[model samples]
Target: MEDRNMKNPLYLQTKMENIRRYSHDALFQFPKKERYLLCRQIEDCIERIIREVIRFQKRYYKKNTLQEIDIELEFLRGLIREAREESYISNGRLADWMGHVDEAGKILGGLLKFYQEKEAGRSGK
Candidate 1:
């Protein structure tokens, strides 16, 4: 059978799009003071994650890039939590952001495991 994953190679594309959309909407609701600070940081983190994911796909040695992506993902999650705690975002918005983050995390985790196993097999041979 053909590889289904190859047909839609960018598995995280939809998740990234959801993140970008929600981050903009939720950040727009933040206070003017946070617009330049927390908002910019969140947007930067999201963009970095997207860039890192694309880099991860293009590079042959994805381990380092994946680690960077994982770190950015966690950082993004923390920023979202902070936004919710500071009342910058509502609980409903938090839930929406969390759902997208969780989905991306699951996909990233699976990819990380696959790479790790592949590396191990190569080293063992």
Candidate 2:
């Protein structure tokens, strides 16, 4: 069994936890009118990414899961953009949160490369 602490270079567990925390903080202060809209959408986006990251870390695919994860990731990106446009995320706030997301994505890229290599290796290509 792998250690859940810090053996993994990806640091996805911590990233996902940050996502959850950030989203919770973001949503908690949102006005009631936004409860069903931006709040919900941001929550969903963060939650889905967390799920995909967890899945990626646990299961490297023989076939590509990028197509699958990309779908969710795209939605998350759209939600972030939408949040910015809605002013739900102020410029400073967006910068801070997206900066973390960027760092997380870099770590995630390493994991993605691992899966891609594993798939190629399996195919003997």
Among all candidates shown, the one with the greatest TM-score: 1
Instruction: Tell me the TM-score of each prediction against the true structure.
Output: 0.89, 0.75
Candidate 1's displacement at residue 2, Å, is 15
Q: Candidate 1's error at 109, in angstroms?
A: 0.1
The reply for model 2, stretches above 4 Å from the true place, is 1-10, 57-63
lDDT winner among the candidates? 1
lDDT for each residue of candidate 1 in 32-104, tens digit (9 for 90 to 100): 9999999999999999998988888799998898889889999999999999999888898889889889878
- The models' CA-based lDDT, in order, is 0.83, 0.66
Steric collisions counted per model:
0, 0
Instruction: Report the C-alpha lDDT of model 2 over 6-33, residue by residue, as the tens digit.
Output: 2353476577688779868876766789
Overlapping backbone residue pairs in candidate 1 total 0
Extract clashing residue pairs from model 1: none
Regions more than 4 Å wrong, model 1? 1-9
